[model samples]
Target chain A: MHRVRLGIVGCGIAARELHFPALVQLTDKFEITAVTSRRRERAEDFASMVKDALGYEPAVFDSYEELLESGSVDAVDLTLPIELNVPFIFKAVEKGVHVICEKPISTDIENGKKVVELSTNTDKVIYIAENYRHDFRFNKIRAFIDENTIGRPIFVAWHLWIGMDKSNKYVQTEWRQRPKHIGGFLSDGGVHHIAALRVIFGDIAWVSGVTKRVSDYLGDDDTLSTVFEFNSGVVGNYTVSYAVSGKQYFEIVGTDGRIYLDEERITVRGQREETINIPNQNTFKNEFEDFYRVVKHGEPNILGHPVDALKDLSFFEAAIKSKDTRIEIEDLLRSTTPD
Target chain B: MHRVRLGIVGCGIAARELHFPALVQLTDKFEITAVTSRRRERAEDFASMVKDALGYEPAVFDSYEELLESGSVDAVDLTLPIELNVPFIFKAVEKGVHVICEKPISTDIENGKKVVELSTNTDKVIYIAENYRHDFRFNKIRAFIDENTIGRPIFVAWHLWIGMDKSNKYVQTEWRQRPKHIGGFLSDGGVHHIAALRVIFGDIAWVSGVTKRVSDYLGDDDTLSTVFEFNSGVVGNYTVSYAVSGKQYFEIVGTDGRIYLDEERITVRGQREETINIPNQNTFKNEFEDFYRVVKHGEPNILGHPVDALKDLSFFEAAIKSKDTRIEIEDLLRSTTPD
Candidate 1:
C-alpha cells in the first residue's frame, strides 16, 4: 500500500492531543512527512514525536505557506484556529495539495462558500474533518431509526448541559474563551451537534431559537434553546448550555417506541426494552480513516464533504442569529449563494 | 367548621373520577348540594356516588342553569368540556354564586378576556381550578428553585411524549378524540405543562415555536416544539408529543447544580447530591383545598386565580399561533384587555 504523505498544520492542543495520537495508529495509511505551526518549537516537538513513533524524520516549517512550498507532503491535516481555517484551506488547495480541514470551514458563510467553490473547481481532495459524522454512536442511532426498531420518528429532544469551567482543558483555550466565531463556543463547538442531527434526521428546514449570554468567561452566547423542523415534518427541541451542570442525551421518540442515546448506552423502549452498550471508539481515528479512504482509494465522501460542513455551520449560524424568529435554513443558504 | 355548599356542574370523566374522589375526602370543607351535566344519567350516577360517600342526598339537576337557580350551593365546581368553561363561569357568577371553574378560562383571547373582566369586577370568588398550580410536586419544585439550591437559574428542558392509544380512557373520550378546542389535545392537555412552567419559571416573555401533525387520530397538531424566553431572560425548550411513546421529564440546569423532575423522583446534582422522593398526592384534592380556603376564609387565591389560568391559556394560544414568528406573552395579554 502506498502511504499518503501527511503534513500536520497546527501544533495546538487538538493536533498534539487528538490528531497525532490517532495518526500514529494508521502508519500504513498515512506517513507524517512534515509539521508546521506559528510556534516553531511546538512544530519541532510534534515532528520529533512523529519521528520517534513512526521511525521517520519529518520536515518542520515555520509557516503554512512554507509547508505548502516545501513539497514534503501530499495532504495537509489542518487543525488551526477558527479564523484561520478557510484562508489556509484556500492556500493548500491553491498549492495543489489534498486538504482535510477541521470543522467549521470558516467563521461565516461567505468564506465557507469560498471553500465549496474551491473544492468544486479542483480535484485535490478537500474534506472537512467533522468527527461527529464519523462518530460511531450517532451511526448506531441512525441505524436504529432506519431499522424501524422505534417505528417512525415523531419528535426528538436533545439536551446538552456542560459546565465549561476553568478546570476543563477546552475552556482554558484562549480563542474559545473569547471566540472570534459567530457565537463563540456556541458555533465553534455547536457544529458537531448539527452534523449529528443532519446525519440522523436529514436536513433541517427551519429553526426558531433563543440565546442567552450566561458566563462572562465564555464569550458571545453560551446558551441556546431551539426548535428545529426537518423537511420530513418532524420537529425537535435542542437546549444546550455551557454554563450549567452536566447531563447529555439525544432522544428520538417514535410511533411505537423511543430511542435514547447517551454516552454509556443506547436505550430502546418499546414492546421489548433493549439496551445497547456503547463501546469506546475514538471518533478522530474514525474520521482519519474515512479521510484516508477518500484521498487514497477515490471513495465517495459523505462525512468529509465541504458542503455538509457548510450546511452544519449555516444551521448553527441561523440558530444563533435567529433572535426569536423562525429562520428558514434554505433562505440563509440562498442568501449566501454567490451572485 | 362550616362546610361550603358545592354543586357539581359536570358529570363527565373528570367530574366523576377526579372531583368526586377528591371532594369526598374534603367533607369538612365542602358539602355536595347538587349535580348537573349534559347527560342526566351521568349526573345521577355522580350524585349517588357523592351520597354513598358523604351520607348526603344531593339534588340532581338536568341543566347547569337550574343548578344555578336552585340556590342550594354557595359555590359550584365546573369540570365541563373546554368550550363550556367560560360560558358556565358567567352563568354561575350572574347567579351570585362563587365558582371553581376548570382550565383554561376559554379557548381563545376574546372569551378569556371576558373571564378576566368578570373576575375582576365580581366580589364573589371566581377561581379557575388549574390543578397543576396546586399540585404538591410542582410546589416542591418551586420551593427548590426559590431556595437557590441550583444557584442562579440558567436554562430548562421539558420533554413530554405520551402515546395516546385507543385503550387510554382520555383518548377514548369523544371530545378529546375530536377536540373542539384549538390545537386539539395539544391545548386541552398542554395547558397543565404551561401552568407548571409558569409556577416554576414565572411568566414567559416570548415564545418561538413549531408544530407538527403526526397522527391521524389526533385532530390537530399533536406535537409542538417551542423555545420560551422568560421575563427574567432565562430561556428553555419544551417539546410535547401526544402521538409517541411515553417519556416525561423536566430538567433545570443551573450554575451550582441541576434538578431532574420525572414521574418518581426529584434528582438533584450538586455539591452534595440528593434525591427527593415525590409522594403521590392527588392534585385535584390539593386544588379543592386551595379553592375552599379562597371561598371560605377569604384568603388570597394564587393557584385558583382566574387570571392565572387565563395567562396559562394565553401562553398556550400564543405558542400554537406563533407559526414562524416570536410571540410576546405580555403583548398577547395586553391585547386581551377589556377595551
Candidate 2:
C-alpha cells in the first residue's frame, strides 16, 4: 500500500509525544510531508527530531492555511488547541483533505456541529482521535460486554484521574486550563470519558454535572462528577478528578459481572471473576496505525466516523450546560449556549 | 466472652441475606434473642428460621419498640427502611441498646444529624454498616494511597454500576425505590459511593447532580450522576445507575497509581501495575465478625465505631441536598434537613 502523506498542524506535546513518534514507527503507513506551529523555532525543533531519527525532513510552514494549500499532503492532523483547530478543521474539509482531529473538536457546541456538517457535505473523513476507545485493554472489555460474559449492565462507574505537573513545559502552554479556549476540564478531559461511555454503553439520554476548579493554577474548574442516563435505561456514575494524586483506571459494572481496565491489566467478574494481563504496549502507536489503515483502506476504525464524533461532542456541550444551568440535558439539538 | 443477645428489626432482605446468616456463623459471639417485623407472618417465619437452625426459640414482635423493651436483647440491628430506621435508631438509643443500622442512616439530613447528636449524648454505640469501606479490597487500596504508592492524587474517576433484576422478590419489596421513603436511587445506591469517596478522600466541599427515573414501577429516580469537590482541592465525579444491565465495579485513580475493584478482583497500577487475586469472601460475614469482636472484646474494628457511621450518614445527607438544590454543598451542617 502507498504511504499516506501527512501534515501535522500543531507542534505541542501531543504532536511531540504521540504524532511525531508514531509517524516515525509506521514509516510504511505514513510520511510526515509538512509541519506547522505558531512558533517557527518550536516547529523547527520538532522537524529536526524527525529528521535525526527517521532520516526524512519535511517542509515547514508557519501558517496552517499555507500548509493546507501547499497540496503536498493528502491529510492533515489537527493537533492544535481546540480554539485554533475548530476553524482549521473546516478549512481542511473545504480543501478536500481527510482529517483526524484531537478531542473536543471545538469548545463550543455550534462550532462543533458546524464541523460535523462540513465533513458530511465534503465527503472527507473526519476522525476524532479518542485514544481510550482504541486502547487494547478497553477494546477487550468492550468486546466482553458485547459477548455477554458479564451479563446485562445495570450500572457503570469510571475513574480517570491523572495528576498534572503544572511546571511541565507542555502543560504550561496548553489551552486546557482556559475556559474560553477549552471549556475547562469538563470540555477538555471530561470529553474523553463521556465519549468512551457512549461507545461502551450506548447513547446517553440525559446528563447533569457539577464542575469546579480545585487547583489554583487553572482559572476554570478541573474537577467534575457527571451522571449519565443511557437510552437503554442503564444508570452510570463517573467521577473525573484532575486533582487526584494517582494513575488512570476505568471500570464497568453489569448485573452478572464487572470489568476493570488500567494501563497494564483488565479484571472482570460476574458468575466468575478473572484478571487478564495487558502488556504495556505504546497505545499512541497503535492508535496511529489504525488511523493510517482507515485513511489508506477506507476501513472503519473503532473511534467512529465524523458523525459519531459529533454525537460525542454534543454530549460534551450538554454536560457544560448541565453544569451551568443545573438542569438535566434531555435534547442535544435543542440545547443552546452563548457563542 | 459472654454472648451478646441480638434483636433484629425488619425481617427484610438485608436481615435475611446479611445479618441472619452472619449471626448464625458467629454463634460464639452472638445469640438471636428476638426478631421483629410489621407483619406477624414474617416475624413468625424469621423466628422459625432461627429456631430451626440454632435450636433456640427467640421471641417475636410485630413492632420494634416491643423488641427493644423485651429486655432479652443487648443490641438491635435496625435493618428497616431508611425512613423507618432513623426513628427506630432513636428508640433503640433511648432504650440504651447498642445499634447497628443499615446505610443512609436516614433519608433526611436533619434526622441523620439528630441521630448523630443523640448517639453522642448516650453511652450506646451506634455502628452504621458501611461494608464498602470494610471490604478488604478498598482497604488495601486505601493503605496503598496512604503509603503514596500512587503519589499525590490530582484526579479521580470513580464509577460503580450494578445491574439489578426487577423481578427479584427481594428487590421488589425494597423501599429504596420510593423517593418519599428512601430518597430514591441517589440516596439509596448513591450514598454508598458518596460515603466511600468521603472516607477515602475527605469532606466534600460542593456537589452538583442530575437525577432521573427510568423504571415505571419505582417512585424514585433510577439514574443519577453528581460531581463533588473535596475541601483538599481534590475534584471527583460520581455516577450511579440502577438501569445498567451488568455487575458492580469501583475504580480509583491517584497521582502515581490506580486501583480497580469489583466483586471478584482488585487491580492496582503505577510505575509497576499488578492485578491481585481477591478472594470472593462474603463481606457481610467480615462485617459481622468485626462488630462482634468490638462488642465482645473491646477490639478496634474501623467500621465498628459509632463516629464513623455518623460521618457516613452526614455525607449521605450532603449528597441528597446537592442533588436537590443543584448547587455545590460547602456546609453539610447547614444544608441538613430536620428529621
Candidate 3:
C-alpha cells in the first residue's frame, strides 16, 4: 500500500490539538510531508509539536501555495478558518491533489455550493472532517435506530451549552470571537452536532429556529434553538448555546423506546433500562483513516463525502436564515445520503 | 376560615380518578355538597365514589343547572369537557357562586375571551383548574429560578411522546379521539406544559410551530413542535406527540444552570446535580385549596387566575394558528401577571 504524502494546511489550534495526534496514529497510511501557516513561527512550532509527539519533522511552509508548488504533497488536510476554504480547495483540486477539509465546507451556502460543485467536477477526491459522524457512540445509536432496536425514530433533542470566558481558548481566537462568517459560534461549533443528525437521521428537510446573541463577545448568534423536520419524516429539536453552562446532551425518541446520550453514557429505555456499549474510538483518527482508505484503495465514501457534509452546512445556513427571516425555512428537501 | 361548600360537575374519568381523591385530602378547606353529570347514573356514581373516598355522601345532580340552582353549593368545581366550560361558568357566576373550571377555559381564543370578559364583569371569583401550576415539582423549579438558584431563565424544552393505543383509557373517550378543539391532543394535554412555561416565564410574546397528525384515530394535531418567545425575553421550545413512546420530560435552562423534570423526579443541574426535592403534594388538592383561600380570605391568586390560564391557551391557539397559516404567530404580548 502506498502512503499518501499529506500537506497540513493551517497550523492553528486544531492542527496542534487534534489533527497531529490523529495523524501520528496512522503512520502506516499517511506521511506528514509539509505544514503551512501565515505565522511562520507557529508553523515551525506545529512541526516541533509533531516531532515531540511523534519522532518526525515535516517541512514547514509559510504560505499555502508554496506547499502546493513544492510537489512534496499528494493530498491536503485543510483546517483553515471556514470562509478561507473555497480557494484552497479549488487550488488543491486543480493541482490534482486529494483534499480533506474541515466540517462546514463554508459558512454560507453560496461559497459551500462552489466548493461542492468544483470538487465534484474534478477527479481528485474531497472529504469532510465531520468527526461526529465518525464517532462511535453516535454511530452505535444510529445502528440501534437502523436495526429497529428502538422502533422508528420520531423525535430528537440535542443541547450543547457551555460558557465562554476570557480564560477559554476559543475566546482568545479572533476569528471565532468575531468571524466574517454569518454565524460565529453557531457555524464553527454547531456544525458537528448538525452533521451528526444528518448522518444518523438522513437529511434535514426543513427548519425553524429561535436564535439570539446571549454573549457580548460573540458577534453573531451564540444561542440557537431549532426545530427540524428530517427527510425521514421525524422531527428533531436542537439547542446550541455558547453562553450558558449546561454541558451537553442528546436524546432520541422512537416508537419502541428512547436513547438518552448524556455526555458519553448512553441509557436505552425500552422494555427495561439498559446501558449500551461504548467503544473506545479516536474519531479524528477514524476520520483521517477513512479518508486514507478512500484515497488509497478507493473504498466507497460512507459518511465522509463532502456532499453529505454540505447537507448539514446548508441546514445550519438555513437556521441562520430562519432566524434572520423570522420564518420557518421550507422547500429545503436537499439530497439525502449522497451517492 | 370558612369552608366553602363545593359542587363538582362532570363525573368523567378524571372526576373518578383525580379530583375525588384530591377532594378527600382537602376535606377541611372544601366541603363537597353536590356532584353533577349529564347522566344521572354517572352523577350518582361520582357521589358514591366521593363518599367512599372521603367519609360522606354528597347530593347528586343530573344537570349543571340543578347543581347551580339547588342552592346546595356556594362554589363549584367544573371538570366538564373543555368546550363545555364557558356556558356552565357563566351560569355559576350568574348564581353569584365562585367557579373554578378546568383549563384552558376554552380551546379557542374567541370563546376564551368571552369567558375571561364575563368572569371579569361579575364580582364572583373565577379560577381555572391549571393543576400543573400547583404541582410541587414544577413550583419547586420555579422557586429555584425566582430565588436565583438558577440564573436568568433563558430557554425551556418539553417533550411528551406517548402512543395512544385502544387499550389506553384516554383513547376510550370520544372527545379526545375526535376533539372539537382546534388543537386536539395539543390542547387536551399540551396546555398543561404550556401553562407551566407561561407561569415560570412571563407572558408569551410570539410563537411558531410545526404540527401534524401522527395518529389516525385522533382528528386534530396529535404532534406539535413549537418555539415560544416570552415577553420576559426568553426563547422556549416544546415538542409534544401522541404517537411515540418517550413518556414526558421538560428541562428549564437558565444562564447559570438547568433543572430537569421527568415524570416523578426533579434534577437541578447547577453548582452540582442534586436530585432536588420532589415533595409529594396532590396538584389537584393544592389547586382547590388555593382557590378556597382566594374565595374565603380574599387571598391573591397564584396560579388560579383565569386570565393566566387564558394566556397559556391563547399561546397554544397561536401555535395551532401558526401551523395552519404556515407562519410565526407574533404580536401576542398579552398581560404577564394578571390583575
Candidate 4:
C-alpha cells in the first residue's frame, strides 16, 4: 500500500506532543510531507524536531492555503483551536483533501451540522480524530460487553479532577486560559471522553449534568459532572474538572460483570476477576489507520462521522444549559440539536 | 465510666446483626439490660445470642411499652422498620427515655420534623445512629481536610452499584421488595450513604440528581445519581444503584489533594500519593459510645441531632421529586420542609 502523504497544520502542543510522535511511529502508513503554522519560527522548529526524530525535513508553508496550493500532501491534520479548525475543514474539502480534525467538530450545532453536510457530499474522508475510541482498553471493554462477558451493560461512570496548577503546561497558554466555547475546562477533552463512551457503549440518548468555574482565575467553567443515558438503556456518569485534586478513570457497571479503566489499566470484575496493565499503542497510529481505511478501502468512518461526534458536544451543551435552566437532562437532550 | 443501661427494641436483621453486637463492644460504657420483640421467639433467640456473644442474659419484654414502663434501662435502641420507628421514637421520648434511634429520623418530612421538634423541647439526648461518623477512615479523611492536608475541599463523588439479584437477603422480604417510602431502590441504604457523606464531608446544601428504576425486580428506584453543593462551597457527586454491578465508595476532591474510600481502603492522592488498607472496625460501637457521651455526660450530639439527619432525607426527598417535577435541587431543598 502506498503511504498516505499528510500535511501537519498548527505547531501547537497537541500536534507536537501527540500527532507528531504518532506520525514518527507510523512511518509505514503516513508520510508527513508538509507542515504549517501561523508563526514561521514555530513551523521551522517543528520541522527541525521532525528531522531530529525522523531524519527528514519536509516542506513548510507560511499559510495553510499555501500548503494546500503546494499539493504536497493528500490530507491535512487540522490541529488548530476549535474556532479556527472548522473553516479549515471547508478549505480542505474544497481542495479535495481528506481531513482529520480534532474532537468536537464545532462548538455549536449550526457549524457542526455544516461539517456533517460537507463530509456527506465529499468522496474524501472526514474523520474526527478521536484517539480514545482507538485505545485498546476501551475496545477490549466494548468487545467484552458485546460478547456477554459482562451480561447487559447498566451503568457507566467516569471521573477526573486535575488542578490547573498541576495540569498540562498548555493550560498556561493565553488562548486556552479563556475558552471561547461551551464545554469549559476540559472542553475538548470532554468531547474525547464522550467519544470513548460512544465507542465503548452506544449513542447517548439523554444527559443531565452541572458545570461550574468557581475560581475567577479560570476563564471558562472548569468543573463538570454529567449523567448520561445511552440509547441501549445504559446509564453513565462523567465528572471532570481543572480546579480540584487529580483523578482520571471510569467504571462500566454491567449485569454479569463490571469494567474499570484508567487509561493504563483495565479491570473486569464479575463471575471472575482480572486486572491487566493495558499494553500501550500509539492511539494516533490507530486513528490514522482507521482514517486511511475510509480513504483507500472505501470503508465507513469507524471513529465517528461529524454527526455522531455531535452527541459529545451535545452532552456538555446540556450541561452548561442545566447549570442555568435547572432542566432535566432528558428534556435538554430530547431535541437532536444540542443548542 | 458508669455503665449506661440500654433496652433494645425490635429483633430484626439490622438490630440483631448491628446494634446487639455493638452494645456488647461498649460493655465498659453500657449494658443491654432489657430487650423486646413482637415475637417472643425472636426476643428469646436474641437473649440467647447475647448470652453467647457477651456472656450475659438481658431481660426480655413482650412489648417495648412494657420495657419502658418497667424503667429497666435509661435509653432504648429503636430498630423497627422506617414507618414504625417514628411513633416508637415519640413513645420512647414521651416516656422520658433518652433515645438512639436509627438513621433517617423518618421518611416523610412531616414526621421527621415532629421528631426534630420533640427532640428540641426535651432535655434528654436524641442521637440518630449514624455509624459512618464513627468510621475510622471516614473520620480520618475528614480530619485531613480540616487540617488543610488536602487544601480546601472542592468536590465529592461517591458511587455504588449492586445488582438486586446479588443484594442483601432482606431484599427478598415483602416490604423491601416493595419500598413503602421515598429514596427509591435501596432507600434505607440510600439514606445510609447520604448520612455517610454528611459525616465525612459537610451538610449538603443543595442536591440535583436523576434516579430511575429501569429494572422491575427492584422495589425502590433502583438507581440514583446526584450532585451536591455543600454550604462550604464544595461540589460532590453520588451515583448508586441496586440494579447493577456492586461498588461502594466515595471520593473527596480538595484543592491540594484527594481522598478515596471504599469501606476497607483509603486512598490519598496529591502532593503525595498513598493507598492505605484501613482495618474495618465496628462503626456501631463508636456510634453507641457517642450516644453514651450524650446521655452520660450531657454532650451535644456530634454526628447529628434529629434536625441534622433531616437534611439527608431532604436530599433524597428532592431526588424523588426531581424525577417528576424537574425542579432544581437548590429550589426543592431551599425550604426546610421537603414540599
In model 2, what lDDT does residue B271 have? 57
lDDT: worst 10-residue window of model 2 chain A? A329-338
Better of 1 and 4 by DockQ: 1
* Chain B TM-score against the true chain B, each candidate: 0.93, 0.86, 0.90, 0.89
Clashing pairs in 1: none
Residue-by-residue lDDT tens digits, candidate 4, A49-148: 9889888898999999999999888999988878776799999999989999887777655566678778779888888887888888778888878777
TM-score of chain A of each: 0.93, 0.88, 0.92, 0.90
> Model 2, range A1-339, lDDT digits (tens) per residue?
398888888888888887777777889888888998899998888788889988988899989889998998888888887787668887888887888888777766556666666665776778778776666665677788888977776666665555466774534765665556444655676666766777677777665565555567654766666665677766666666565544444666665667777776888876667889997677677777788878788887456465556556665555555555432211211232112
What are the lDDT figures for the candidates, one per model?
0.80, 0.68, 0.77, 0.75
Off by over 4 Å in 3: A47-59, A271-277, A296-302, A324-339, B1-6, B22-35, B47-62, B65-74, B94-97, B161-165, B212-221, B243-248, B262-276, B296-302, B324-339
Sort the predicted structures by DockQ, highest score first. 1, 3, 2, 4
Model 1 DockQ reads 0.24
In candidate 1, how many Å is residue B250 off? 3.0
Sorted by TM-score (best first), the order is 1, 3, 4, 2
- Scored against the native two-chain complex, candidate 3 gets a DockQ of 0.15
Name the regions of candidate 2 deviating beyond 4 angstroms.
Answer: A46-50, A53-56, A174-179, A270-275, A280-304, A325-339, B1-180, B183-339
TM-score on alpha carbons, each prediction? 0.91, 0.62, 0.86, 0.81
Better of 1 and 3 by lDDT: 1
CAPRI-wise, candidate 4 is incorrect
What DockQ class does candidate 2 belong to? Answer: incorrect
